[model samples]
Each structure stands twice: as structure tokens, then as C-alpha cells.
Target: MTIKKLVEQIEAKKSFLCVGLDVDLEKIPTHLLEEEDPMFAFNKAIIDSTHHLAVAYKPNTAFYEAYGLQGWRSLERTIEYLNERHPDIFTIADAKRGDIGNTSTRYAKAFFEDLQFDSVTVAPYMGKDSVEPFLAFENKITILLALTSNAGAFDFQTRSLEDQELYKQVLQTSLNWENAHNLMYVVGATKAEYLADIRAIVPDHFLLVPGVGAQGGDLEAVCRYGLNKQVGLLINSSRGIIYASQGRDFAEAAAASALSLRTQMQQILDAR
Candidate 1:
């Protein structure tokens, strides 16, 4: 999906919520484990229940990869199910993949071609060459890990080099690349104060913000500084939504959680 399409969906739905599918088999309801493919079964239920409330669904690859081949198959099936049933919903493979040169191309093809994800999170630590390969694909976005939501982010991202924080340098440098408009960023909502400065650097690009809800990042603060004319934000809520219940009505509980976020998002859009 193009960024235009993504923004359109955000407007049409009156939401900018991106539901994170960080499914842990151990944490999912035990009843789902009885299914032949528990991971996919759980994901299908979540998607079916919350599709109307979300503009995007991000499946964090580590959740599936942890189970080896069955996990990969489940991931593939889940992506296929979404594409077939809910093509309008933006899909993100939260693989955080980046490698040197040719290898990066293969990784790009695997997700953008084989699995057909609309975007993939990429680590820009390897510099431009490693990330540029993912940008070669049309309408497929490279969500560069900038200021992340984790505690580890301060170890390097906040370090000043050449009189600017390293992540700020990344935002500025990435804009100069070819097809850079196809790029979005992973900005932790926890760093809400920096959003205004980050916006000054790349005002138009969409920001895939994690750290809301369970992580306690304030949604109102994120919008106040991060939002642009196009509603340039995809606020994700994973555990807070997907794990809202551990009972047979898990999907309904998930939907309710998603609806709560969507309701807040609609209010934000209206205020804007």
C-alpha cells in the first residue's frame, strides 16, 4: 500500500491505530493451542475482530520465528489470510531486517515479494547501502529504526555526534536518499518531547510510534508534536489490546481494546 492509501484509510476509518500482532504462543489463550496452527488461528481471530478499528496490522517476525519452520509457515499463512480478506488494511512485517548489499535485496524480496508486506522495519545502523536496498521496491516502505521505545535506545540513539543526537543525524541523512519519500520512521512515543524536533526534520513522513498503552506513552503528547497535515502517525498498542483477556471471549476483548484506542484516535483527528 502507498502512503497515500495508508493516509486515506486513516481518514476513512477516523483512526490512525496500528494493531501490533506480537503474539506469544505461551501467552495466548490455551484453547487456541489446540488448533493445528495456533499462531495463525490467534492472528485470524484478532484481525477479524479488529479489522474495522485498525488502519494497519503489524506482525512482529520474532514471535513466529521463535517456533522454527512451523512458525514461518504460520507467518506466511497469516499474511496470506490478511491479503486475501482485508487488503485495504496496511500490513507491516516488523522483521527489523537489514544486511549488507545483495543480502539486503534478498530480504527485501522475501517480505515485499514473497510475503507481500506493505512495509518492514529496518535497522539503519549499517548505513545507507544496507537500507537503500529495501527502498528499491515500489510502494513498499522502509521503516527505519530511529528513536525506539526501548530502554536500550539511549545507549546510542541519544549520543551526540557532530553536535546533534545520532538519531537526528539519521533523520536528516535519510531524507537525501533516492526514493526517500517511500521511507517512514520508527519513533518511540516515549520520546514525545523530541517529536517536535523530529517533525522539523521530516514533517511529511509517517511515524510508526510504539510505546503507547502498556508502555505508558501518552497519546495526546504524541499527537501534539508528531502529527502533520496528513495525520502522520500510526500509534501501535500490542499487549494492551491483544492480551486484553485470557478467556474464550479473547477476540471480543481485543476488539474492545482496539475500539477504545480508535475512539481516542478519532477524537485526536477531530481536534486536529
Candidate 2:
């Protein structure tokens, strides 16, 4: 979807909430295990229950890749269901993929053509060449990793090179790449304080923020520094929402959890 379309969805729903569909069999309701494809079954229920409360759904690829063929099938079915049903809801394959020339193009095809994701998370460490291939695809976005939510982010992302920090350089350099306008960023909610400085460099681009509920990243603080005129924030809550309950009312509970975040988002948009 275009950024304009995404903005419209947020306005229509009174939400910029992006639900993370990082499904885990061990954590899902045990009853879902009885289904033919437990992972897709769980995802279908969650999407059906909570699609209105969220404008985006991100599925980290590793979770599905780990399950091998069965896992791959589940991932395929889940995306198909979303595309066939909730086409308006932005889909992100959090693959964090980057590779040499031809390889990168194939990766792009795998997600954009085969999986039909609107966007894919990509590692910026390889610089322009590795990322531009994904950007080459029309209307598809590459969510380049910047400052992440994990504790290890500080090790390299924050380190000063010459005078500027590594992550800052990554942001500034990426803008010069071909099709740079198609770029969004993965700025973790835990790194909320640095958002103002990050915004100084790339203010208009949407930020796919993780680390909110379960990770204790302050939603208010993230918005204070990160909100652009378009409300360029997709504040995500994965485990905190999807795993809100492990019982029969799992879907209902997930919707309730998502509703809480969406309500807060609506208030923020109202005050804006």
C-alpha cells in the first residue's frame, strides 16, 4: 500500500497500531494444535478478531522458517488469507534479509511476488547495493534496520565513526540511494529517546516501532519525539497482545489487548 493509503487506514480506524503476528506454537492455545495447520489457524483467529483494531500485521520470517516445510506452508496460508480478506491491512515480512546483487533480487521476488507482502524488513549493514534491489520493486517498501530494540543494538548502531554515530550515518547515507523515498525505518521503541535526533535526519518516513508493551518502551515518549505530521508510527505489540491469554477466549483476549493500544493511539491522534 502507498503511504497515503496507509495514512487513510490509520485515520479511518483511529489507529496506527501494527499487530505483530509472530506466532509460536508453544505459546498459542493448546486447542489450536488440533487443527491441520496450527500456526495458520492461530493467525487466522487473531487476524479475524483483531484486524479492525490494527492497520498492519508483521510476521517475522524466522518463526516460520524454523518449522521447515510445514512452517512454510502455514506462513503461505496466513499471508494468502490476509491478502484475500484484509487487503487494506499492510503486511510486513520481517525477514531482515540482504545479500549480494542477484540474490537480493530473488529475495525481493520471494516476499513481494510469492508471499505478496507490502514490505520487508532489511538489514542496512550491507549498504546501498544490497538494499536498492528491494527498492527496485514498485510500491513495495524496505524497512531498513536502524536503531533496534535489542540490548545488542548499542554495540554497533550507537558507536561513533569519525564524528557521527554508525546508525546516524546509515540513515543519512541511505537517503542518497536510488528509490530512497520507498524506505521506512525500524527504530525500536526502546530507543525512543534518540528519535528526535533520528527525526532530524529522516522526519517524514514511517517508523515501524517494536519493544512497546512487553519490552516496556514508553508509547507516550515514542510519540513525543517520533510523530510526524502524518502520524508516521506503527507502534507494535506482539507477545503482549497475541499471547494475552492461552485459553479458549484467546482471540477475544487478543482483541481486547489490541483495543487498549488502539484507544491510546486514537487519543494521541485526537490531541494532534
Candidate 3:
């Protein structure tokens, strides 16, 4: 999906919520295990229940990769279902991939052409060569990791090099790359305070923020500094929403959890 269409869905739904489908078999409802593909069954139920309350769905690749071939197939089926049934909603493959040029291009083709994800999260540690391959794809978004929600981010992301934080340098430098207009960023909601500075640098790009709810990142604080003219933020919630219940009403419970966040998002937009 294009940014214009994504923004339109946000406006129409009164939400910019991105539901993280980071499914873990051990944590899902046990009843779903009876299905041939438990993971896909769980995802389908959640999507069917909460599609109206979100503009995007992100499935972190590690979750699928951990389950081996079964997990990989589940991931495929999930994306295929979304593309065929909910094409209007954005899909992100949170694969955090980065490699040398040739390898990166193959990774890009796998996600952008084969799986058909609208966007994919990428690591920028390898710099321009590793990332531009993903950016080269027309209409597909390359969401680069900037300041993240993880505790270890301070190890390097905030480190000053020549008196400038590394992540700031990343944000500024990435803007000069080829097809930079297709760039979005991964800025953790836990790093909300730095968002004003982040916005000062890339005010127009969308930010995929993933530290709210279960991670305790304040939604109001994130929006106070993260919102741009286009409401450039995709606040993500994973375990908090999907694991709201492990009972038979799990899907309904997920919808309620998502609705709670979406209602708050609507209020934020309305007040703005």
C-alpha cells in the first residue's frame, strides 16, 4: 500500500494503530493447537476480529523462523490471507534484514515480490549498500531501525560520534540515499523524548513505533512529539493485544484490546 492510501485508512478508521502479530505458540490459546496450522489459525481469528480497528499488521519474522518449516508456511499463509482479503490494510514483515548488496537484494525480492508485504523492517548497521537494495523496490517501504525500544539500544544508537548521536546521523544520512522517499523508520515509543529531535530531522516520514502497552511506553507522550501533519506514526502493540486472553473468546478479547487503543488514538487525532 502507498503512504497516501495508508494515511487515508488511518483517517477513515480514526486510527494509525499497527497490530503486531508476533505469535508464540506457547502463549496462544491451546485450543488452536487442534488446527492443522495452529499459528495461522490464531492469526486468522485475530485479523478477522480486529481488522477494522487497525491500519497495519506486522509479523516479526523471528516468530515464524523459530518454528522451522511449519512456522515459515504459517507466515506465508498469513500474508497471503491479508493480501487477498484485506488488501487495503498495510502489511509489514518485521524481518530486520540487512546484508551486502547482492544478498540484500534477494532478501528484498523475497519479501517485496514473493510474500508481497507492503513494507519490511531493516537494520542499518551495514549502511547504504545494505539498505538501498530494499529501497530500490517501487511502492515498497523500507523501515530503518533508528532509536529502538530495547534496553540495549543505548549501547550504540545514542552514542555520540563527532558530537552527534549515531541514530541522528542515521536519520540524516539515510535521507540522501536513492529512493529515500520510500523510507520510513523504526523509532521506539520508549524513546519518545527524542522524537521532537527526530521529527525536526525527518518530519515527513512515517515512524513505526513498537513500545507501547506491554512495554509501558506512554501513548500520549509518543504522540505529543511524534505526530506530524499527516499523523506520521504507526503505534504498535503485540503481546498486550493478542494475548489478552487464552480462552475461547481470545479473538473477541483481542478486538477489545485493539479497540481500546484505537479509541485512544481517535481521541488523540480528534484533539489535534
User: Could you give candidate 1's per-residue lDDT for residues 103-190 as a string of tens digits?
Assistant: 9999999999999999999998998999899999989999999999899999999999988999999999999877898899999988
Error of 3 at 20 (Å): 0.7
Window of ten residues with lowest summed lDDT in model 2 = 210-219
- Mind giving the per-residue lDDT tens digits that candidate 2 earns over 171-213? 9999999999899999999878899999999999999998899
Better of 1 and 3 by lDDT: 3
| Candidate 1 Cα lDDT to native | 0.93
168 in model 2: Cα distance from truth in Å? 0.5
Badly placed stretches (over 4 Å) of model 3 are 214-217
TM-score for every candidate vs. truth? 0.98, 0.98, 0.98
Best model per lDDT: 3
RMSD of each: 1.0, 1.0, 1.0
Worst 10 residues of 3 by lDDT: 211-220
